[model samples]
Target chain A: MVELLAQTGLNAVYAASYISLVAVGLVLIFGVMGVVNFAHGELFMAGAYAVVALYADMHVPFFVAVAIGMAFVGLLGLLMEWALFRPLKDNPLGGLVASIGFLMILQSLAVMGFGVRMEHIPPVTQEVVRFTDKVGLPVARLYVIVAAVVFLSALWYFLKRTRFGWALRASAQDPEAAALQGISITQTARIAMFIGAALAGVAGALTAPLVSVNPHMGHSVIVTAFIVIIVGGVGSLEGAILASIAYAFVHTFVTTFWDGVLADIVGLSLMLIVLIVKPTGLFGSADRA
Target chain B: MRNFLILLVGLAALIALPHGLSFSQQEILVFLVINVLLVTSYRLLTLTGEWSLGHVVIMGVGAYSSALYTKELGVYVPVSMLLGAVTAALLAVLLSFPLFRMKGFYFLIGSFAAGEIIRLIWKRFREPFGGVRGISGIDPMPDFSVGFYQFDFFEPVSYYYFAGAIVIACLWILWRIEKSPVGLTFHAVHWQDKLAQASGVNLRAYRTLAFAIASGFAGLAGALQGHYVGTVNPNSFDIEVMVFVLTWAIVGGTATFYGPILGCIVLTVLNEIVLREMGLEQARPLIYGAIMILSILFLPNGLESLVQKATRRKTTAKPEEKAAT
Candidate 1:
C-alpha cells in the first residue's frame, strides 16, 4: 500500500512538471500580451512533431532534437506575433480569434504532414530508481521532474534578477508605465512569446515519448492548460504553476483510483469549487479578480 | 415594414428549406440551425462583455440532461428539454454570483471553469450521462396531431422544421432583448462597467441574467441536437466545439445577431466542400487558420461589417459623383 502511494506520488510529480510548464507559459503570454494565445497547445504539438520528424524519423540525437524543437517552435511563436498579434495589437479579441484560426491551421498542417495516426516515440530511458521492492520511479519521468525544477528556477531567476526580466514584468503589470520607465513593450512582447513558446515546446518534447502523439493531442492539453490557468487566476504566473501542480495531482490521483473520465470530472469540479470560494484563485490578487 | 418583410422572407425560406434539400442535406441544415442557435446564444451572453469559452459545455449539459432523462427516466422529450434548460440556467445563475465579481479575462476563465465542471459531472456519472460514450439511442420527438395536421418529428424535414421553429422563436426573444432597456444595460456594462455601476445599474444582475438566458437557449439547442443526432457524447461538448462556435461568431461578426448565422452557413459549407472535394484532410486546419488570421487582420468586424461598409460606400459614392459632375 505504501509502495502504491509512493508510485502514485511519483506519477503526480511527473504530471505536475509538464502541467506547470504549459500553464506558466500560458500565464506569461496572457500577462505580457493581454491576449490569450489559443494556439499555445498547438505550439506544443508542433514541438512534439518536430521530435517525431527529427529524432524519431531521421535518427538525430535526442537532446539535439529537443533543443531544435524548442527553438523551432519558439521561432514559430515569434512569427505568429509578427504576423498576427502585432497587427491586432489594438484588439485583443482579434488576436485571440486569429490564434484560434492558427490553431486549426497547425492541426491541419500536422495531419497533412504526419497523417492522423499517432507517431510512436521510443523511450529515452529504460532505467528506474527503486525506492522499495514494489516502488520505483521511471528515469524518463525523473528527467521531466529535473527539467521542470531547473527550468522553473531559471525562469524565477530571470524574472527576479535580470534586467530584461524586470522589463517584461513591468510591461505585464502596466504597459504604459513600463514604457515611461524606458522599457520597450515590443521587445518585451517578443521575449515573452519566445519564452512562452519554448516552455510549451520543451514540455511537449519531453512528454512525447510517454504519451500518444497525434494531431488532435493539443486539444486535450490546451483544455487542461486553460483549466490550470483559470484555477490559478489569469495573469498570475505563480498561481499558474501552483494551480498546475494541484490540478495535476488531483487529476492524476483520481484517474489512478477511479477512471479517466471521472478524473476529468473531479478536476473540473475542483475548479468550480475554487471559483465559488475564491474567485481570485489561490495566489491571485483581488484587483485582478 | 422593410425589416418585417425581410424577416418574413427569411422565415419562409427556413420553413421551406428542408423540403428542397435531400435527407443528408437536411441533416446538415439541422446541424446549421443548431450551430446558429448555439452561436447566437453565445453572442447574447457576450453582450455583457463576459466572453465564455465554455458554451459548448452548457450545450452539453442540455444535451446530456435531456438525453438521460428521456432515455433513462422515460420522461417526455419536451419536459426533459425544459428541465435541461432550467438546470443549465440555474447552474449559470449559481456560478454568476462569484464569477461576476471578476472582470475581463478573469470572468472569461471563470465561466470556462464552470462549463468544464458541468462537463466533468456528466462524464463522471456514468449511470446518468453514459460516461465517455455518452447517452445513445435518444428517442426522437414523437408524432403528434394538432387540429388539422400530423407532425412526425422523426422525419428529416419534420425535424428541420421543428429545429427551425425553435431557432425562430429564440431569435425573436433575442431580438426583443436586444431592443429593450435590459439590452441597453448590457451594452452599458460591456462598454464601461464602472460607469454602469455608478449610474445605479446592477451590473451583476444584468450580467448574470444575460448568462442565464444564454445558457438556457444553449440548452434548448442541445436538446434539439440530441434528439436529432440520436446520440449525445461527452466528446461533442469539448473545447474544440467551443472553439468552432467561437470561430463561427468571429468570422460572421459578433456585434450583430445574424453574424453567427452567416458564419455558420459559410464555414459549414466550406467545411463540407473542402473536406469532400480536396481530400485534403490536413489542409483544413491550415485553411481555417488562414481564414481566421486574414479575418482578424483585415476584417476584424467580420463579413457583416464588410457588407455594411460596401453599402455605405455605394450610397456615399453617388452623392460625391453627382457633386463632381
Candidate 2:
C-alpha cells in the first residue's frame, strides 16, 4: 500500500509538471495580452507533431527536435498574435472565437498531414530508475519532469531579473500605465505570446513519446488546462502552478483509485465549487476578478 | 404592410425550399432548420451579456431525457419533447447557482466545465446514458395526416416542415420576448448591470431567466434533432458542436435576431452545398476555420452588418423620396 501510494505520488508529480507548464503559459498569455488563447492546446499538439515530423520521421536528435518544436510553436504563437489576437485586442470574446477558429485549422491540418490515426513514436530511452522492486519511474518521464523544472526556473528568472521581464509584468498589470512608461505593448505582447506558446509546445514535445499523439488529443489537454487555470486563478502565475500541482495530485489519485471518468468529474466539480465559493480563484487578483 | 409581405414571401420560400433539393440535400435542410433554432437560442443567452460553452450540452440534456422519457416511461413523443425542454431549463436554473457567480471569461470556463461534467456523467452511467455509446435508437415522432398534407416521419421533407413549424413558433416566441420589457431588462443587464441594479432590476433573476429560456429552446431543438436522427450520443453534443454554434452566432452578428439565423443558413449552405460538390468534404473544417478567422478579422460585426449596410442605404434613400412626395 505504501509502495502504491509512493508510485502514485511520483506519477502525480510528473502530471503536475506538464500541467503547470501548460497552465503557466496560458496564464502568461491571458495576463499580458488579455486574450484567452483557446488554441493553446492545439499549439501544444503542434509541438508534439513537430517532434513526430523531426525525431520520429526524420531521425533528428530528440533534444534537437524538442528545441526546434518549441521554437516552431513559438513562431506559430507570434503568427496568432499578429493575425488573430492583435486585431481583436479590444474584443476579448472575438480573440477567443478567433482562437477557436485557429484551433480547428490546426486540428484539420494535423488530420490532413498525419491522418487521424495515432503516430507511434520511438521511445527516447527504455531505462527505468527503480526506487524499489515494486516502484519505478521511466527515464522518459524523468526527462519531462526535469525539463519542466528547468524551463520554469528559467522563466521565473526571466520574469524577475531582466528589464524585458519588468516590462512584461508592468504591461500585464496595466497596459495603459505601462505604455505611458514607454513600454511597447505590441512588443511585450509578442514576447509573452512566444514564451507562453513555447512552454506548452515544449511540454507536448517532451511528453510526445510518453502519451499517444493524435489529432484530437488537444481536446482533453485544453479541458485539463482550463480546469487548472480556473482553479489556480485566471491571471496569476504562482496560482496556476500551485493549482496545477494540487489538481494533478487529486486527479491522479482518483484515477488510480477509481477511474479516469470519475477523476474528470471530481476535477470539474472542484472547479465549479471553487467558482461558486471564490470567483477570483484561490490566488487571483481582486482587481481583475 | 411591407414587412408583413416580406415575411409571407419568406415563409412561402421556406415551405417551397426543400422540394428543389436532392434527397441528401433535403436531409441537410432538416439539420439546417434545427440548427437555426439552436443558434438563435444561443443568441438569446448572449443578449444578457453572458456566453455559455455548455449550450450544446444543455441541448444534449434535452435529447437524452426526451429519448429516455419515450423509451422508458412510454410518454407520447410530442409531450416528451416538451418535457425535455423543461428538463433542460430546470438544469440551467440549477447550474446557475454555481455558474452565475462568475462573470465574462470565468462564466465561459465555468459553463464549459459544468457542461463537460454533464457529458461525463452521461458517459459514465451505462444504465441510463448507455455509457460512452449513448442512448441509441431513440423513438421517432409518430406519423399523422393533417388534412391537406400527410405528415410522414421518415421523409426529410416532412420532418423539415414539421421541424420548421416548431422552429418558427419558437422564433416567434423568442422575438416577442426580445421585443418585450423583459428583453429590454436583459439588454440593460448586459450593457450596464450596475445601473440596471440601481434601477431596481433583480440582475440575478433576469440572468437566470434568460439562461433558462435560452436553454429551454436549445433543448427543444435538441429533442427535434434526436427524433430526426433516431439517436442520442455524448459526442453528438460535444465542444465541436458548441464551436459551430458559437461561430454561427459570431459570424451572423448577434446584434439582430435575424443575424444568427442568417449566419446559420449561409454557413450551412456553404458547408453542405459548396464543399460537398467540390468533393473537399474532408477539408471542410479547414475552410470553415479559415472563414471564421477571415470573418472575425474583416467582417467583425458579421454578415448581418452587410445586410444592415444595404438596408441603411435604401432606407436613407427612401427619406429623400418621402420629402419630395
Candidate 3:
C-alpha cells in the first residue's frame, strides 16, 4: 500500500508539471489580454501534432520536434494576436468568441489532416526507473517532469529579472497605466501570447507519446486547465502553478481510488468549494478577483 | 388592429411552414423551434448582464428530470416536462447562491465549474442517469388529435407544430418580461448594479429571478427535445452544444429579442440543409468556425445590427419627412 501511494504521488507530480504548463499559459493570456483564449487547448494539441508529424512520422529527434512544436505554436500565438486579439482588444468578450472560433478551426483541421482516430507515437525511451519492487517511473514521464521544472524556473527568472518581464507584469496589473509608462502594450501582448502559447505547446508535445492524441483531446485538456487556473486564482501565475500541483494530487489519487468521472466531479467540487469560501482563490489577489 | 392582424398572419405562416418542407426538413424545423426557445431563454439570462457558460447544462437538467419523471414514475409526459422545467429553475436558484457571489469573468468560470460538476454527477451514477451511455428509450409524447389536425408523436411535422406552439407562447412571455419594468431593472443591474441598488432594487434577488426564469424556460426547451428524441445523454448537453448556443446569440446579436432567433434559424438552415446537401458534412465545424470568426471580425454587432440599421433608417426618414411637413 505504501508503494502504491508513492507511485501515485510520483504520477501526480508528473501530472502537475504538464497541467501547470497549460494553466500558467491560460493565466498569462487572461492577465495580459483580458480575454479567455478558449483555443488555448487547441494550441496544446497543435504542439502534440507537431511532434506526431516531425518525430513520429518524419524521424526527427524528440527534443528537436518538441522545440519546433513550441516555436510553431508560438508563431500561431502571434497570428492570433494579429488576427483576433489585436482587432478585438477593446472587446474582451468578442476576443473570447473569436478564440472559440479558432478552437473549432484547429480541431477541424486536425480532423481533416490526421483523421478522427487517435495517433500513437512510439516511445522515445523504453527505460523505466524503479524505486522499489513494485513502483516504477517511465523515463518519458521524467522528461516531462524535468522539462516543466526547467521551463518554469526559466519563466520565473524572466518574469523577475528582465526588463521585458517587468513590462509584462506592469501591463498585466494595469494596461492603461502601463501604456502611460511608455511600455508598448502591443509588444507586451505579443510577448505574453508567444510565451503562453509556447508553454502549452511544449507540454502537449512532451505528453503526446504518453497519452492518446486525437483531434478532440483539447476538450478535456482545456477543461482541466480551466479548473487549475480557476482554483489557482484567475490571473496569478504562482497561484496557477500551486493550484495545478494541488489539483493534480487530488485528481490522481481520486482516479486511482475510484473512477475517472468521480474524480472529475471531485475536482470540480473542490473548485466550487474554493470559490464559495474564497472567491479570489487560495493564493489569488483580492483586487484582481 | 393592424398589429393583431400581423400576429395572426405570423402564426398562420408558422403553422403552415412544415407543410411546405420535405419530411427531413420537417425534422430540422422541430429542432429549430426548440433552439429558438433555447437561445431566447439564454438572452433572458444575459439581460442581467451575466453570460453564463452553463445554460446548456441547466437545459440538460430539465431534459434529465422530465425523462426520469415520465420513465420512472410513469407520469403524464407533458406534466413531467413541466416538472423538468421546475427542476431546472430550482437548481438555478440554488446555484445562484454560490455563483452570484462572483461577477464578470469569475462568474463565468464559476458557473462553468458548477455546470461540470452537475454533468459529472450525471455521468457518475448509472442507476438514474444511465452512466456515460445515458438514458435511452425514454417515453415519447402520447399521440392525440386536435380538432383540426391529428397529433401523432412519431411524425416530425406533428412535433414541430406542438413544439412551435409551446415555443411561441414561451417567446411571448419572454417578450413580456423583457418589456416589463422588471426587465428594465435587469438592464439597470447589467448596466450599473450599484445605481440599481441605490434605487432600492434587490440586485441579488432580481439576478436570481432572471436566472431562474431563464433556466425554467430553457428546461422547457430541453423537455421538448427529450420527448421528441426519446433519449437523453450527457453528451447531448456538452460544452460543444453550449458553444453553438453562444455562437447563435453572438452571431444574431443579443441586443434585440428576435436577434438570436434570427441567428438560430439562419444558421440551422445553413448547417442542416445547405451544408448537408452540399456533401460538406465533415466541414461543418470548419465552416462554423469560419463564420464565427468572420462575423465577429466584420459584423461585431451581429446580424441583427443590419436589421436594426434598416429599421432605424426607415424610422429616421419618416421623422424627417414629418418634420419637413
Report how far residue A244 has shifted in candidate 1, in Å.
3.6
Candidate 3 lDDT, B1-325, residue by residue in tens: 9999998998899888888899989998999999999999999999999999999999999999999999899999999999999999999999999999888887888898998888888888999899888999999999999888899989998899889889989999999999999999989999888999998999999999999999999999999999899889998998999999999999999988999999998899999999999999878999999999999999987898888777767877643232210
lDDT of each: 0.84, 0.94, 0.92
- Candidate 2 on B47-154: residue-level lDDT in tens? 999999999999999999999999999999999999999999999999999899889988999999999999999999999889999888888999999999999989
* DockQ list for all candidates: 0.64, 0.77, 0.75
TM-score winner between 1 and 2, please give it. 2
- Candidate 2: stretches off by over 4 Å: A286-289, B318-325
- The alpha-carbon deviation from the true structure for residue A64 of candidate 3, after best TM-score superposition, in angstroms, is 1.3
Higher-lDDT candidate among 2 and 3?
A: 2
The lowest-lDDT stretch of 10 consecutive residues in candidate 1 chain B is B316-325
Residue B227 in candidate 1, Cα distance off native in Å: 1.2
Q: lDDT tens digits, residues A1-289, model 1? A: 7777888888999999998998898888888988888899999899899999998999898889989999999998899888988899999678888888888888988988898999998888899999888888889888888888999899999999999999999999899999999998999999999999999999898888888999989977887898898788778988998898888888888888888867876776677666667766778883332
Q: Model 1: how far is A264 from its true place, Å?
A: 3.1
Query: Model 1 captures what fraction of native contacts?
Result: 0.86
Model 1 residue B225 lDDT score: 91
lDDT per residue for candidate 3 within A137-170, as digits (tens), equals 9999999999999999999999999999999999
Q: Give interface RMSD for all predictions.
A: 2.3, 1.0, 1.2
